[model samples]
Target: MTMSKTRSEGSLPVVSLPLPVDVTAPAVARQAVRATLGGLGLDGPEVDDVLLATSELVTNAFEHGEKPDRLEVEYSDGRLTLRVFDSGTSRPKLKEPSPMAARSRGLQLVHALSDDWGHELCSGGKYVWAVFSLARADASA
Candidate 1:
């Protein structure tokens, strides 16, 4: 994955990540998120939550969708939004895993960890997003 930034002369700060659809994408994304959040002075459990949520989303993209074009991490209005854009039409949904199952828990983890999560179908593909507030208390502990 490659990290890129775009900001107007006086506009919102946006950080965009373009990652290949591969197994290593999740690790790369985590590192990028850590650095970004650290630069923004967000650390401890909150950072951990964001990392976990991002991993789950990225993993899902690779597992269920076509090669994703990018993963976006945006910080605006005191909220952080993580998005995975893939060339897939199906929207993600939470499912109940069987007691003995080892897979299919990514969405559940995301749902429980993120303050708000959803998806939208775009012209070329679908994008799944999870939003978290910087000032919210850590509820995962």
Candidate 2:
């Protein structure tokens, strides 16, 4: 896996990690997100929420999408955003899982944890994203 950090036009930090299209992707994503966000001086329950949301997006990409590509994290204007790209045309939906179900709650958890979340179709495939408001997150801490 390859990871790099860059700056957007707004001079905010953006980190991207190419993820392996396997079971290990979620763990790898969590580790990278923790280190990257921590290095940016972000911590506490909000950061943990971001981590959980990131894991859900990556997990969804690996399970439902095709050829998961990379995970990107960006911080800008008091908000942090994460995007998971995969070569799949299908879009994810927010569904309420059954009480007895063993899975399918990833998106629900993401919706609860993130300030906003959605997916978009790109030229190659699609990317699912979640955004967190740092100001609100800090207030909750």
Candidate 3:
């Protein structure tokens, strides 16, 4: 994984990374996410929600989509945005998994936790994204 500071959005900083396509992608992503959010002075539930959502996006790419390529993470104006791009053509959607099923609730958790979540089809594949609100008042809690 590689990280670099990007142009600022308003007063908040933006950071983007190009990650490898491997089994360790999720772990790598979680670490980067923690550092970025921590550096921005965001903590507590905001950090937890973003970490969980990041894992879901990366894990979903490894299990259901094609090779994962990049992750763009940004904190701007009181919100966090995470985007995971992959080389698969599959469209992301929520599924109704049986109660006894051992898996298949990644997107569901993202949908429930994030203020908003969605996926966009790109030229080569698709990019899944989620946004979390972390206003100053909420971050301190």
TM-score of 2: 0.91
**Clashing residue pairs, backbone N/CA/C < 3 A, model 2:** none
lDDT of 2 by residue, 1-141 (tens): 567876673765689999997999999999999987877667778888998998999999999998889999998777899999999999898998999999999999999999999999998899999999775345446
**What's the TM-score of each model vs. the native?**
0.88, 0.91, 0.91
lDDT of 3 by residue, 25-132 (tens): 999999999988877777777688889999999999888888898888877878789999898988887998789999999999999899998999998899999999
Question: lDDT per prediction?
Answer: 0.82, 0.89, 0.87
Off by over 4 Å in 3: 137-141
Greater TM-score among 1 and 2 belongs to 2
lDDT by residue (23-129, candidate 1, tens digit) is 98889888888887876667778788999998999899888878776887787666888888888888798999998998999999999988899999987899999
- In angstroms, the error of model 3 at 48 is 1.0
Off by over 4 Å in 2: 135-141
TM-score, prediction 3: 0.91
Pairs clashing within candidate 3:
none
Top model by lDDT, which number? 2
Clash number for each model: 0, 0, 0
- Name the TM-score of candidate 1: 0.88
